[model samples]
Target: MKQEPSYIEALLPILTLVGLLTMNVFFFEDTLAGSNQVALLLAATIAGIIVRRNGQAWARTMENVVSTIGSAMPAMLILLLIGSLAGTWLLSGIVPALIYYGLDIINPRVFLITAVVVSAIVSLATGSSWSTIATIGVALLGIGKAIGINEAIVAGAIISGAYFGDKISPLSDTTNLAPAMAGTDLFTHIRYMLYTTTPSFIITLLIFLVIGLSYNFSEAVVDVANVKSAIDGAFNTSPWLFLVPLILFVIIIKKVPPIPSLMIGTLLGGVCAVLFQPHMVSEIAGNVPNYAEASYIGFMQAMFGDIIIVTPDADVNELLHTSGMAGMLDTIWLILSAMVFGGIMESGGLLTRLTQPIINWADSTGSLVASTVVTCIFFNTTASDQYISIVVPGRMFRKSYQDKRLKPEVLSRTLEDSGTMTSVLIPWNTCGATQSRVLGVGTFDYLPYAFFNLISPLMSILFAYLNLKIRRYELDEIPVEERIN
Candidate 1:
């Protein structure tokens, strides 16, 4: 006989998972190296056991797990390509050139705010925060480091702006997905979101501006010249190197799929390395006499293995090494492990079981929106994927909003404010893990500093409680069937 899980049953795997992950922090210095992945797998096993005991077949649970992993395949592939792209870009001097030129033009006093604005514009234009963070965000971090700012704080600024642009951009997948899940039109959701989003973004910028101005850059000024000189000595820091990223941005804006766009970027970076940094390429190839063999060997190494460019300055050398596609394997392992846990919990209805009380408690309008935000964050933490966070909560709350005569855009906007924004804050979530690996900054390290992300959900709740711009549907606009129900 089939049995429905009790609340305790639903909570068991999650509690166990959280406890294990917490223990991992104390036990391992680098948790993501393997410990975190093991923790996820163990948690999935516990969930699988519960599902089987609840009368779901093991085969069925495995099927769901397979489907979930399949869905994450695209993300895993993109990570690999990004790793390769970073490697080749470094080899080609594109990254160094950006850092070199950026140091010359960007004032250390205003660099944090500038990073935020620059990342925002790029993310807004491309409608992809991932691409923006991987390419330009990496360079910005290097520039920030050369100027003596903490990498975590710089990463926070980059993520804040990137996510801000992603949340509002018409082309963003999450922006589109939120509306679809909540039964709202795209433009309606976006317009309604500005009421809360605009304020949060303004506050974020103001905070960064203040932090930027407070910094004393007297010492960093000396280091910047040394950094630029080291980069200039190692590779050709030509303006032409900027063309590779410009072309990548154009392809992203033109709506080419992410995988193909990343692949193209990686190849273009390789070509640029051969054309513009031939001497360095030969050096990377162990100074082989034949230029053709050296080019082939260097390009292959940049795409798949460790590549380093030693510079006179130690800080510059730190910025010049890359691990290529092989480095992304740990992140991929984490994603697959997370998906396994998510699949089991979802297939067994454990997540819904756990969230039922939250929905039930959402009687008042303010509480309803608050509940939605909490549920979305909960899902982001437990499910380890942002799309699941939006989809699950949006589906759960859509009817509740309609029943309360709230506009669907309210639900959509709340979903973005919480779901889309907070996913990158959770260490195990796909967005968080990928960004951490890409930027070489830990998720928790930047969480406190990602002001925009930290503020968005609170902003959403504040609006709902204050009845400020909380749009309600006119009685006439409510469907007759819903009114009767």
Candidate 2:
């Protein structure tokens, strides 16, 4: 006896959520911690009330919310592992070695460009933009500050490069998830993405290069040697420490599952800490007489708790801390809250109702792609989670793309172009909150500089409008009855 809710009822929850979020942002500014989570819960409750009034059982709605949150368990586990990996890597000398080496090779004039390139390389190898930002991204931020560069610009370049790699890397969850949701394979999605991704990345790199070269170093001389010395003194900076990341890369390249790969990487980081950074581990252990016991205590603490590595240099000290798995809880909370809201909308048919108008307006291939992009962005803004943004539009548009004789890769690429990249641009989204906490940069402060993210959706639309590489399946590949003229 379930009845569909009216369009106004469907729209009310979204409007309420938006209004609350705007007020939260305006009043709290950078300190709007947990406000949006509350907003999402309130929105979900409002949606539930409307759906119940329309004859949908409250039990069924709660069931959908639980099921939706359950589906996100893998992502939650990955977030925890990433936090553990960051802690162990910092304790071990792997992260310090990277910073020490990166500082040595980079000149002030080219530092911004180098930051982008280095971040891109790391994210590509690990297939994790979050890990890249938490680790090397933090060290680069310190280095940039010491060299008199704007922190906001540094964060922008770092994010731009990290997300570029995340978009294309086979090991990325979003890359895998996008294709799975859009009815395509991972490699095919990546291959199709290159048509727009490559050009956008090249343009982004060129812009960073120009910005790097324009920096005037005479006014603010960087003391690279001093920073290196501090890092070396604080940890055992050596090339041997790189074996940890090398093993991680090898496991990823071998197509091992991400959870296992990150677990192995975390364990390797602990071993490296024990072997190469015994003194630091002992210090973290605090009063343990046995080295073996100290190593155990140190590694356990780093895996599950928080640790701060104090250095003589104040700037370097800020860069040398990790909150382990506990730090990821806030982000996990945000994701769960968002899932509840999205689940309510989905179960109530609100998302379908909201998306119908946009889908109906897609008369041509170009218009179709544009509408998909806009829908993805809209979800990112209103849904406040990247995964929801991807999943919802992807589900809504799958049949539309197939009906239009477009390939599944087109839908997948559009999801990533608008959904994945734009998530970090919004202050209330889970990606934005996690990254801002990790990199110590606000979303708005770095939004203007994330050139790759800003350009990706536009690039997708441009390719569609220009009829460039918009691959459709062979006419014979379509069913006779379903094929459109």
Top lDDT prediction, candidate number: 1
Please give the TM-score that candidate 1 achieves against the real structure.
0.69
Counting clashing residue pairs in each candidate, in order, gives: 0, 0
**Model 1 CA deviation exceeding 4 Å by range:** 108-202, 208-220, 361-450, 459-485
Per-residue error for 230 in candidate 2, Å, reads: 2.6
Q: What are the per-residue Cα lDDT tens digits for candidate 1 across 1-485?
A: 66889999988987787677667655676666788778878988898899999999988888978976775576566667777887898899887887677656556668888788777765664456887788667777877887678899999999998999889865466776677667665566777899999999999999999888867663344555676789899999899998988998787667676668878988999999999999999999999999999999999999988988898886567557778888778767776787788778878878668767876888788999999999899878876667657765765676678878898899999999999999999998778988999899999999999999999999999999888997788878886533312
The residue-level lDDT of candidate 1 at 376 comes to 91
Q: Estimate each model's TM-score.
A: 0.69, 0.76
| Runs of candidate 2 exceeding 4 Å displacement | 29-33, 108-112, 118-198, 210-223, 363-369, 376-416, 419-450, 462-485
| Candidate 2 local lDDT, 1-485, one digit each (tens) | 88877779888987887777656655654322577778788988998898888888888888878876776676677778877887898899887787677655565677787777777765765467877787667777877876677889999999998898788875465776687557665556777898999999999989988888877653232444666778989987888887878887677667676678889989999999999999999999995999999999999999889889887776566557778888767667766787788778878887667767877888888898999888788877865667667766775677689877798899999999999999999888767877898888999999999999999999999999888998787767975533322
Worst 10 residues of 1 by lDDT: 476-485
Which one is best on TM-score?
2
